[model samples]
Target chain A: MSPLSTLTPRTLKKPSPARSRLRGGARYAPTLATVGLFLAMFAVGAGMYPSFLSGQVFLNLFIDNTFLIVLAVGMTFVILTGGIDLSVGAVVALSMMVSATLLQQGWNAGAVIVLVLLIGGGLGLLMGLIIQYFDIQPFIVTLAGMFLARGLCYVISLDSIPVTEGFFTGMAQAQIPLSGDLFVSPGVLLALGIVAIAFFVLHHTRFGRTVYAIGGNEHSAMLMGLPVKSTKILVYALSGLCSAVAGILFSFYSLSGYSLAAQGMELDAIAAVVIGGTLLTGGTGYVLGSVVGVLVLGIVQTFIAYDGTLSSWWTKIVIGGLLLVFILLQRLFARKAG
Target chain B: MKSLLKHRLAWPVIALAALLLLNQIFRPDFLGLRMQDGHLYGSLIDIMRNGAPTILIALGMTLVIATRGIDLSVGAVVAIAGAASCAYIAASPDPGSPVTAATAVLIAVVAGLALGVWNGFLVSTIGVQPIIATLVLMTAGRGVAQLITGGQIISVSNDHYKSIGAGYLFTLPISILITAAVFALAAVLTRRTALGTLIEAVGINPVASRLAGLRARNIIWIVYIFSAVCAAIAGLMISSNVTAADANNAGLYIEMDAILAVVIGGTSLAGGRYTLVGTVVGAFIIQTLTTTVYTLGIPPEVTLVFKALVVITVCLLQAPKARNLLNRLKAAPKPAAKEAAKEKVAI
Candidate 1:
């Protein structure tokens, strides 16, 4: 029997209620917590200024946070496979540059999008191939990928390029009206649709099962003939596609693309995925959890912003602290689970 | 002599010669050694001086990697140490006092030790993977540094601190001497002591090592603490060189370089069988490659792509399967076609 065979049956365990609650914290827990946190902030903001919780204020969250949701979805897929894509932020920068450059040359928006996706996916494919075929460490390979992608972005433009195309600007600025005082941005809907599709694919597809399998035990997955290398490569490619899509959302939101735009956003995506209860070692994660994680992070930042006294560096400190805590929690879980 | 020619170092020695030859052809001025102000001055010396931190990090990384673990937090620890020492100096009444210097060094070392302990505890007792454990510090350590500096770069004009990074000793750069001393100390600690054997045993097979009466956890803890201290020293060098503590960019991406140095030195990431000398040589190779790229007028952006290519090629050459395939291809070309077909189908 294989060394992992002993743990196979136990893998089907229905986590105890408390354990399930911990894992499910990203879903139900985040909602309640976010609501409570939001109300507290809203009350404080109202006390400081009476119109802090206005409809426009609420709409700002969707406008500002839509790109993060898309990025988080891509991160979720990568983490589900027990791998990471540190190069996502770089890919976003690269894709944005590609789109910005192409659009400047009068290429059709559709063509620009296709070009960015193909380039991003091609980079991802190269990274995945190196990592899988050469048996190189994923972290190093992705680190190199990060450098390569970011370098290309710099080579395209050393600084920010304002996206001047009217149609591109209009598409990015387009807003969707909702009932009553609430309005949803098109980017928000796009992010939500991607998340929903990600949920369906992860929970209801054989490919998702293969990802879980690979994360659980690569050797076992190989023995079971589960197309391990192809799965690994495909997930990276998906991550690249997601990054490109997020780049579009970001460009629409900001109407600019800069090489340094997403310098450290990869860390945010990582923290979100981990906070959502995804194991860094792979296996056992949910896309919805990542959405909640991103919201939690976003809300925390909003709270910090409302304070007006804290430096932006506090975001790093808070995320870093929470990351440490979640990692410790994961360690504890692994110890108990082991 | 014949056996020495067959030694592992022979490959790197030959590679170094080839690199020099290539440099002489492309940039002949690179081999032009000279002396200035009673000090040896040349590209080689410049490489050593600038690469002091990397070489120091790689030596410690060698020991850590030997335990089948890595220290991604070293770069962060460097920032933390730099911040700690700088803050201590800036806030002190007598920054030039020996006591202040000692206290600052002590405090920085202690902080780094504490950080390492947290990482070790997570990896050994709490069962977090080494990479993940160190990653926590890798992310948080910078935050701690930022918090220490109050989000500002702290500048110091202390001669004592400056000497550590830029001062001369016996007509040579202090950084070089400090690095050499640390390397020697590491060599003695690993080669002249049983600790080295224990670390190797633990790395090779922790369970077996434990069954054989070794405390693998304690060993891991020691190695982490050691790695952190090395990072502290590097931090001192960096801050002293600039006479200011720039927490934001200090030791950025150093972890990658350290890993690269260790790998190029022929040390396996899978652990066991430490290579102190090889790692030092690897550090030299990386530093030389950087300088070479600059001298060759390659744009800084293309440097990373070039590095990526080099690292991939190195890893492929190191891969056993690749080596076997190479051998098989050389012996019988027919199997190469078959293997290529298999790879295409697999993709």
Candidate 2:
């Protein structure tokens, strides 16, 4: 036998039951943390500002914050695969620009939506191909993608264009029926549907397992015969599709699309993902965690809004603090895992 | 001579030729080199002068990356350094005092060193990923700088402070001189000592290097401290040139620019190998691109797209896997086609 085989024979053994249990618990930590944080937010908001407990307030939250939640969900998949998609915010701007342009030309909402999704997905597919085939670093590739997409947005429109299409206006203005005057928009429902789909795909699918494997160890996964490159490409495409959806949702609230749309929003998505306990280095996270992360971020802004004295810049400081904490936690967990 | 012509530098030279050709096609007078007032003056010189900051950052970045790590906080450290320098001068006991210049420079350098050590602590001791660890400071360092300056631009009227940026030596700009001095010192230090070998060993495989009895942590710390010092020098140049320190936008997007320069010069962000010379060339490329954009009448907004295209192309060229694949694709169809044609003739 070869020397490698001799070494492998000495190393090959199944994990112990206690170790397995620990791994399982670690896997669920993010999901549990997200739920726990959400509940904590609700309790605090209800206790301190009782108006925040009402269904009407929640509906408003859904209307205003759904775009961020969608972006975070998409970022979760990218992060799980140990890659970052800095281009998502830029792509959102591009998607919105496409939607606005098509709407201006009197295109139907269905056609416009499909076109935006296709453009966004196509851009992501190109970026993914560049990364996988060229073996370039994801961060640099995505940084370039960010520049490319934002430039495309500028090429399309230098200024914000207000949407006038009937379908867009109607859908954006439409409110969900609720008891005692509470209401939500269709965009909120769409965000919920997307998030639910992402959770299911991430938790229950073989593809999800492949992603985790790839993120955990690309070389090992390749040795194990996983289709690593194709899976990575698919995940980036999925992220782009989600970003497109979020772009449309954003239009419902902002009512316009400009080259500057979603400026500095990638930072927000990353912050939410980390706060919800997603590791930046990959191989671990939950979609729900990203959702809670978004909610936490939104609520922090709401609290800051309540206090009229603090500068908006304080939000960046607070988010930076949370990022440091989460990063520290990730480091600790990484050491223990090793 | 033939083998020398086939070196890796050939591609960059060819790319440069192609760029010059493109410029000639688009703007006829782009390649013009003229002497004005006993000084070599042209768009090329301007690119070099402006790109000097990126070159300095890339020099320091080369050391950090050589140790298989990154420093995303250099930009923020730059703002802090500039703010501290300007603040010291502006808040001196005597306005425009000679002591102000010396004290400010000293304080700025020390602050940079302190921040660099803090970054090193997070990565080496806390075991944080260099990217994430440096990111914490990248965010907070700017704020710290702003807080020191009381969120205002502090103007310095001192001749000494101004000369650090605006002074020229024998027709060469001071910024260029500073860039050269730092790079030369770094090149000498690494080449002359065991530091480069230790850094490469650690970067290629940290655990194995550690097992071999190298102090990986100490090297990582030293490199970060070195990077901070380099950034401090660049910050002083900017503050002195402008004669004012604006904390908010002092070194905005510089980290990205530095990273691009490093990557373009063929330094792998994944670590192990380093090229100080390549970094200098990369800085020149970026500077020339910026100058070309303005000279060619392209709008400032479109410059990003141009930059992105260049980066993608350079990255594709530098990637061995991509090159091998392309070669395979080129050679692949020939054998298959020959076999098919022979089979047809036999039939």
Best by DockQ: 1
Each prediction's Cα lDDT score? 0.81, 0.82
DockQ of 1: 0.53
Chain A superposition TM-score per model:
0.85, 0.90
Candidate 2 displacement at residue A127 in angstroms: 1.4
TM-score for predicted model 1 compared with the true structure:
0.89
For all the candidates, what are their Cα RMSDs to the real structure?
5.7, 5.6
- Per-residue lDDT for B66 in model 2? 81
Residue B162 of model 1, lDDT score: 85
Model 2 agreement with the true structure over A222-311: per-residue lDDT tens digits: 898899989999888888887888898888777788998897688789888987888888888888888888877777677667667765
Q: Cα deviation of B216 in candidate 2 (Å)? A: 0.8
Residue lDDT tens for model 1, B236-332: 9998899888888999878878888888778888889978888888788878888777777777766666766667677777777787888777869
| Candidate 1: CAPRI quality band | medium
Collision pairs in model 1: A82-A282
Expressed as tens digits, the lDDT of each residue in A1-338 for candidate 1 is 55675676764555556787875653344334434544675677667756666776666765788778888888888887777888888888888888888888888888888888788788878878877887777777787788778878877888778898977788776778777767777888888999999888888888988888998898999999899989998888888788888888888888888988887778788878777767788876677777767766776677678878987777777877777777776666665566
